[model samples]
Target: ELKAHSEFRFESNTSLQLVLKRGTAEIFGTELAIDIPYNFNGVKLAVYTYHGAALEITGETIVEYTSEETPMPIYYNLHLALEQRRMLKKSPRILLIGSGRNTASKILANYAVRMGRSPLYIDLDVTNGSTLFPGTMNAFVLDKVVNVEEGCPSSTPLSYFYGQTSISTNMRLYKKIIAKMATVLYKKLEQDEALMDAGMIIIAPKWSDSVGFEILQHIIEAYQVTVVAVLGNERLYSEIIKKNKNEGVEVLKVPKSGGVIDRDVIYRRQEMSRQINRYFYKVDNEFTPYSLILNYKDVSVKKISEEFVAPTSALPIGATRIVDDIRVVDVEPSSAMNHMILALSACEQTEDEEAIAISNVFGYMCVTEIDDAKQRMTLLVPCYGKLPKPYILVGNMKWIDHQ
Candidate 1:
């Protein structure tokens, strides 16, 4: 004699779409498919038989199965329960870092809310308090905020990926602070084995790039958790290709021109989050419109003139192309020089004396025609004095095509 039983458990309201198979004993089976409603937990499958002479429920046949449900609160609960069963367990700590904006912070916060988890949000680059606490109306709460001092000693090593400068130096310090914070937070989460088992360490940089990517690498090494990178910039995407050429870092890049808060993007994320919630107890939601905004053609350069004279004071010593409608000149590093150049470039020559005085202090100057073309001007500053490598800066005006 043999006896077999199958049991199914439904954690959420879900309908099982099934196709039944016929058995040799002439046991009839019916196929059913339906959408299980939400919040309906637990269900079972049983087998019964009816014959001409006898009606009977045969060999214990109960199948316990679980439906795929969003992992948010439920996942956290399950994780907590599982941790309690283990003698030694640790909950991982998550750190979400983004550019000094509330977009990334809010998205991550929403994910935490759905998962019944609390997260810490830090605004590393807050020029104004606007993007900080009490952010935009749509911003997410339930996460702590930490504002990094503008000028502080860095705790992490500096990255020379981009040209070295005072700003880059400060960025290194910011990275260190984040790494230290991650370590401290991880230790705290590890205190309770149950919490540890239920905890996860996550860090979502505002966007990936030379600076952001480096910061992400630092955080990954510091906490050693799974990384879900949300790329917003093409530069950042390039960095991922170069860095993780062969490594497995689970980098997710939103399609080009994809805005962070666009309706389509939000819907796509909602569906993705729902699925992730079903599979993982914790999910990270950090999307930004960096790429979309960067790719927008809304802003264009406009020309202010066809032929104009550049203020003499704005011309560099070696600049000989004076007759040319537009002349690009290199200048020495001087506050006065920069101010004068900016003024001359803007065609505000009433302050020409002051501009000249500033120009004398700086090593070079240039004067160009005042026209709509000037609006699209780009200044290329060489890395070395009179060297070939140049760093380009677009003028403050929009480009207008003369078609």
Candidate 2:
């Protein structure tokens, strides 16, 4: 690995005649000579490999040369020169989306700041009542705030059996509130163009909602901005890819095994802090080109995982199923388990008072299920109404059978 010119010296016992040829041969400058004998006992002959890859011997005899200096290692100097070039090309704009959990966002933010760009943190979730969003705001208060709207509710009622109710109406109200808030936030940015000039950073949560998708679409369509980078969950990243494959977006998902975001805000804060430290302290100034080269490595590896992992494959298992007797009112957002229960309960016929009482207590219920030893049956329970078929079988039993 180390290449340099070295001088070889030897004192022979006899006046030995040696031919120094190229590659185990004797040579005198450009001439292929025969035996070259040492006349004196201490007489020295200079042997060197010149630019033509030919071995040459100086005709002048050496008497008492004390010290010899060789050229410095060339590779080390070459590497240093390359590093200097990389440092000159480091850009400042980067958009990092994370789970608000780990160090990914923090690292990127720190990198931006150290590189002379103030990081902007835009929280994607408008409903989750967590301090993570506010914490991000506090950390990067001068940055842009992009509040993404959570999309419309699912088109099914399955809460009654699970003891929950519909949240459609409430979600609609929440959406309006988010839109108003976003407009206000955008207005603030417009009023201060300086802040806008610093560019925007979108810190999005997992993109499992229509709202997140819509927000990204809107931003790409409206703004004349370049998305320098993306960092987030694989699922969310896939959604982004599906939507913008042709846009040449660069997404970087932290490895699942290597301290990535996982819905924990404290972890996220710590990770972000560490990233800031690394970016400012550890990463070399020559990291930009290397990072760019490895940018697609993570994305490609994640894509491979998605293709081979059956569990990760997208499925329509949660899609709405037909309820013969049950009348689905309005769609709403709820936890996945709650949604399943409500869907099963919506197949039964119930009295108006009883339905209202159940709705009052549980929010909204549209399905019911009765489990037997051999089989389980579903009842489509319409809210405050009667269905032609009181019991419409949806699917075979599983939980009851296992029990």
Candidate 3:
């Protein structure tokens, strides 16, 4: 039972189902449809109530508790202000920057969808992709409230394979990819009035240091951010106010919820593993992916080589350095590729470097095995029938199935 002004926070590692028995409550801004069994798997979230509520919860949870203190009032009022802007048809591209674990942006995104607006959800944190895999950055159109049981939307999104779970792996490639993504997605905003009014909610990683803060500034320009919502961290918020130096964008400090817990590196790795499994097999195992065997002559596999670029000050005066960061070179399959994830590129051919690099992903597959002697490989794919394309892009990411 949850009393007025309190929220129930839970962390479940296994399958969990929650039912609202009485009164009214919501999860992440979307109100629960009473009597409906909402399923959760390997997720940490909260169910909050304005008045009071009783819940029927089943399955195991690692952590479960009630917090009387929360930042709901500040968040709800922010949502109301954002809704007002949407009503006036003034597009508000809100950038949510905070702790890596904060879900303030998601709450706002849910609020927008609940209000019948289809805001574009752009996720920049590759550690925990909201719409797709762990190492991908995607901009998904949340047209309707995400089904409570399914968790993530099944529809394919406009995605770029950053190839690394952490941006620190290849910051140049990460930045360039975001720039290209901006050019592609921003055009859609210019063409559709309704979508323009609906706008975007960009979720970014914490600005922990000088490098991260610089990247945040780059993102603000690339996404054409109109508003910046800093959650909880007062030092980070003050730094943005003094250093960001962008007067056109409105910045606000929103208190973080008491339920927000900092997840350690080990926990993040575990979540990434779960995300990979969820992508291929799904949360409930309702779908069965097929095993595809292809000869070396029929298919193409390419891998990106991560390159490091020196800072501008490191270079000599009046000299400019050029780096090929997006290059994907053909690689012969080896035993090392076992359990490696490959992005199914939308492009049919990989001959053009630029086209292959910029192509959006339609699906993903894992290289389960490679028979070097037979010159054939076995792939585990989530889609039915033949793959839409023959060209596949490989990155440094690998997933070892614990199950």
Number of the top-ranking candidate, with lDDT as the measure: 3
> Judged by TM-score, which candidate is best?
3
Candidate 3, overall lDDT?
A: 0.81
Write one digit per residue (lDDT tens) for candidate 3, span 152-259.
555567888877777776777778878988998889888988888998989885455746787898999998898998887898889889887777899899888877
Error of 2 at 278 (Å): 26
Put down candidate 1 lDDT per residue, 323-361, tens digits, no spaces: 333222333322221211121122222322222211111
Provide TM-scores for the models. 0.30, 0.30, 0.92
Report RMSD for candidate 2. Answer: 27.1
Candidates arranged by lDDT, highest first: 3, 2, 1
Task: Show where candidate 3 strays beyond 4 Å.
Answer: 100-102, 206-210, 309-322, 348-352, 401-403
Worst 10 residues of 1 by lDDT: 132-141
lDDT of 2 by residue, 361-389 (tens): 11112223433332333322223333323
Total colliding residue pairs, candidate 3 = 0
C-alpha-based local distance difference test score of model 1 = 0.29
Model 3 clashing residue pairs (backbone): none
* Model 2 bad stretches (over 4 Å): 1-95, 98-102, 126-140, 143-182, 191-193, 209-212, 218-225, 228-239, 245-257, 261-403
Per-candidate count of clashing residue pairs (backbone under 3 Å): 47, 37, 0
